[model samples]
Target chain A: MANDKSSMQLVANGILKENPIFRLALSMCPAVGISTTVMNGFMLGVAVLFVQVCSSLTISMVKKVIHPRIRIPTYTLTIATWVTVIDMVLAAYMPEAYAKMGIFVKLIVAFAIITMRLEMFACKEPVGASFWDGLGMGLGFMIGMMTIGLVRELLGSGAILGYDVLGFKPLLFFILPSAGFFVVGLMMAFFNYIELYYKRKKGFKS
Target chain B: MKNIITIIIRLTLSCLLAAFVMGIFFVMTSKAKKHNEHVNEEKVMYSLLGYKVGAPVPETVKLYAVYRYIVTDPAGKSIGYLVPTGQGAETGFSFIILDLDGKLIEQKPVTVTADDAAEAESRDKAIKAALGAGKEAVYADDKTIIVTDNGARTAYLLSGKFAGFKASISVMLALKTDFGIRGLAIVEHEEDPGLGAEIEKGYFKNQFIGKSFATLKTLDVVKEPLPDAYAKAMEGVKGEDGGKILEQYKDHAIYALTGATISSRAVTNGVKGTVAKFAYRINILDNVLKEQHIVVPF
Candidate 1:
């Protein structure tokens, strides 16, 4: 406890250093499914943001009572409850969008990333730190998925967020689920390249 | 005891704050959302009328009056009223507009935002086919003039333009009725992106051209005969006993999709149902007030 990092450090770590999708490779279920469209990706990001912030703060507050044997279930329940609230609100208001992203929204319950964060970071951190950390992680995941959607929309359909970029004739394969894998792989590789460039410039030995 | 109370208060306060913020967000976005929905409804109405005229923005002005004038056949009989109906298709709510005479005015293309890549591609293909076949028409970008459906038949309507993702199919019969579809735009749907979503394709919509109500009712790829009421009406025309009613829909038969029976049926029935409902209203026109007829010059 004496040697622990600051609250700001925890927040920064979640956003970049310990990013949930790119760095830690978690929550791939929704990440892959909703990444097909920018609208779906954006909404799913908001849902994750809500879940991460609420669950992190709850788990931190209840960390003292949670026994090792029951910790995972408790964390999952907390996450699921937050997801359900967002899901209901979306269904009632944005029925069109909610209808399109159905089933995948409900599957937020089994997202292992939320539980992993609760166990690894939130339990030991202060509530304030945990909340910020969770927010950063959720944002990072959102950015990753949205980036993929943006690329797929632009390349596959020749549009980004409905704005046509390339000639109207688009490469149709870019929007397919199989295409998602190729784009993700290339994106992950790009992220690695950026990380390596900064490390090399800083003269860090591997 | 004090610490326990403090923790409970903190949790409650946080939850309440989140809820309050979300509530405020809803209030702020509600008006714009409602306007978007209203615009979509008008687009649906315009698609079925089968004639291409540009749609006005729904948010700025409400459509207080929308009606179809039934054009009888050479025998001088009244047909059904043409009205618009929305249906679930690949991209969202693709529409088929019809009037009482069993004449399909037009089909409106699917309206989509560029967000969903799969829907966009499918919608584009559908619109292209509809226009290329001269089954639909649209207001071309950079040109204020209303181009014929032939303009769309060769090139994509939404080809180079990007703003709001929308597809509309408009049909025009030789009959000189001013009442026609203004647009058909989809609001929402989860049709299989490529294949099942082909309903938005204009070719499927164009097949309804020149289909009479009697024939549409008995519409089968197998070329079945009309149902009892419709056959009787046809017989009345041929027997020289029927006057106005038999001639109204004698030429309009509903067309059926070969592969997508249910989807085609849904659209065909929707057209028939709307026309029937509107015709019923027109029959009791004395009871239906024209809300926009009161012209107040300020």
Candidate 2:
């Protein structure tokens, strides 16, 4: 599926067509859980991006040596190693950011998006292609999180990235976990609508 | 058999390599991580003492840490407290040995090397030596910090922990010499954001300031809506205005957060208990010092 596509197309595909959160519905836990604020979403997004890219690269490079029976364990180990290294480095160098993202950083290992990419794409692709795929998927997830965060933060608290934008909360419910489902569901429908419009324009049947 | 063996060997090697890489990073960053934590702690301590971040702490404003330890017998029965004299000692550690009834037994200084101070084992060894046989000093989780601004006792900082909505919330409070709260900082908590987490907001925390120990003992978390004017003032009032605003509400109980009364009550109760215990403990310590005629530098 990835052989005919150029690297840029692979990235665009991840961002729009096969978007982790919006389209593919992967890693919904964090997308719903931490997307209460733009900063949280952005921070978790950056951490996940770093881990995803590193894990994908490592798996692709070592795929030749890893036994088929043990590839899942190997992939798990690679993801865990990158997450720990990032967690420690952030704690040491960027403590303020770490304070916000610390809990989420460790949880990235359990994220289905990273592991799924490794299994479906990274392990089968060449090193360079796997790197591009990882980057695209990571960026897609980051964008998805930030989009959810933006809507939640603005509506719930009447703030944007912690800055008081509306001076008064429009809907306190938006900040709650329940609101996350509503936003994600509405966003999915909106994206699906756009996709349907484009498909129809290209004379494609539903 | 050969294929299975290869698979096992490959899996083991991959695990080993991952562990090795993680170990390298952990060892390399452990020191820096510790340093960062120490700095963050000091920053919190200083901020609670009304010092601004990024600015150097003034020489005149000194903070002396008084480590408190409960001296226990071999059977784990509590005996007494081994407290530092806080004499501004430049060398060695000076401790005031007190019996269970707060009777002064002896004042002794344990000469511990700089290297030995970092390790708990060596420090325990020194403490054991000073404490004599059959008694051991167990470090208390709470810390009592004396803040002196130009040799005058300005504030007493105490660390306290209380049960919150999800987990224990650790808070550091700075109290005036008269036992009125000067300021407070939430050191750590895992409360739910946008609900119980509002306890960390300045509007919520600043209300505790200027509340005397007497007021604090009886302080309640009121479910009534917080007045808009007072809320705005509590958000960012300073100097005489802030003092006046706080004084006006000095007798007022804490206003519970909209959806976080449990957390709000937790902090109010925690502060009250912490201050009550500190006041009681400090009174005893003061009496001991006065009886012993030991002059605490701060």
Query: What are the candidates' individual DockQ scores?
Result: 0.04, 0.78
Candidate 2 differs from the real structure by a C-alpha RMSD in angstroms, to one decimal, of 2.5
* Candidate 2 residue lDDT tens string, B1-298: 9998998888889889999999999999999998998889888888887779988888888766666777777554442433434455643466666666667766777666645644567866887887688777787665688888887988999899989988999999999999999899998887877888889999899899888888888898899999876787888854447656766887899999998889999999999999998998888888987877766666
Instruction: Give the per-residue lDDT of model 2 (tens digit) for A1-206.
Output: 44777899888888888999998899998888899999999889988989999999999998888888888888899999999999999999999889866888899999999999999999988988888889999999999999999999999989998899899988889988889999999999999999899999999996
True contacts kept of each: 0.00, 0.77
Name the best candidate (by TM-score).
2
CAPRI class of candidate 1: incorrect
Q: lDDT tens digits, residues A67-114, model 1?
A: 555566567667766776677667656766775676777888788778
Measured with C-alpha atoms, the lDDT of residue B66 in candidate 1 is 21
Q: What is the lDDT of residue B242 in candidate 1?
A: 40
What does candidate 1 score on TM?
Answer: 0.51
Model 2: how far is B84 from its true place, Å? Answer: 4.1
> Per-residue CA lDDT of candidate 1, range B156-241, in tens?
01111111112222222111112122222333434433222444545444344435444544554423433444445433334444
